[model samples]
Target: MATSKSKTSLREDLTCAICFELFKEPVMLGCMHHFCRRCIVSYWKSVRSPVTCPQCRQEFPNKCCFQTNYLVANLVEKVRASSSPASVKYLEKELNDCLESQCSMKDAYISMIRKDKDKMEKIKKTGAELQGRVHNDFQALHHFLQVEEEAMIEELKREQEEMLQGLERHLEALQVAIRDVEKNINILRQTAGSTDQSVLVELPKLNSRPISIDI
Candidate 1:
């Protein structure tokens, strides 16, 4: 294969400065500048007075003072022949295939990125919903537990109050019983001093009274 530099140099050598294409009928000016015959003629006709080389800007005395370069023309013909229609069509097809493949790859990458972003969003949404449900459940549980604790404490207080009232009533009853016993003791002391037969009769009645206390 020819190097890129050599190919570029060869193309530049065969190309006309005016039309910037491969020379149709190559011509040389007095300034040693090359152009297509029609291109140079048209350039001179469009300009005023003396003709100038398009590349070097060199002036020529005669307007039609350009010679047909047979060697350059032959080279141009050979270059044109070498780059046939079949070769040009093959190169075009290759370029089109490469561009199509690159576009398809780019589209595939874009699709993958879009799908991943959608999946990530779905994951975040689901996670947030689950968190909300958990928080609500914990709040409900806390409320229920608080209610249960308060009810239990109230029940304990009620039971404690009832027990304390019962104890107080029992103490009052015991105090009344103690006072009655003391009154009986004083009556016996007086009766023992007197040698009365009536007091001895009442002693039997006092012995008949029940002594066992019921709670």
Candidate 2:
């Protein structure tokens, strides 16, 4: 069984130099380089008296030998019939051969795996950086809320204290007025029990007196 490397080398060797295509009616020059019949003939007509090999540039006094390459032609036929059983067996042999050689599919697969691992590492690093940034942002936001909450609490306390002071002052004033009114009521009640005309007249004046209270 031929190796994949051998098959590739054979394919390269069978390719025509002038047309750079599959050898169509292949012919060999004096330098042993192969080219398509029409392609080489056309190239020679365009060049000067001495025709040269396109690959090696070796000049020949006259036109080089135009020998037919039946081996390359037959190989081309086998490669073209890829769906045939014979071609399939040949490809299988080449694949087996490539397994024994270096720089095969195994090495390529390992290289591909290494590349994906490196990519994953980069992705993980990026994810960590993003998470760290998000965490720091949340912490900053939480601290800001805490500061604002403290300031709000302080303002509430100050407002409540001011309200309490206002209420206390009003209550104190009301208490003092209650004590003064009670003292005057006791004095009037004693004066009314007297058998005097002046006492009765003063009682009517006390009833007419206007009372006021602080809001």
List model 1 lDDT by residue over 4-44, tens digit each.
47767887889988888999889888888888989989988
Residue 141 miss distance in model 2 (angstroms): 1.5
lDDT value for model 1:
0.83
Clashing pairs in 2: none
Top candidate on TM-score is: 1
Residue 186: error of model 2 in Å? Answer: 1.7
The lDDT values for all models are 0.83, 0.78
Evaluate model 2: give its lDDT. 0.78
TM, every model: 0.50, 0.47
In candidate 2, residue 196 scores what lDDT?
77
Which 10-residue span in candidate 2 carries the lowest summed lDDT? Answer: 202-211
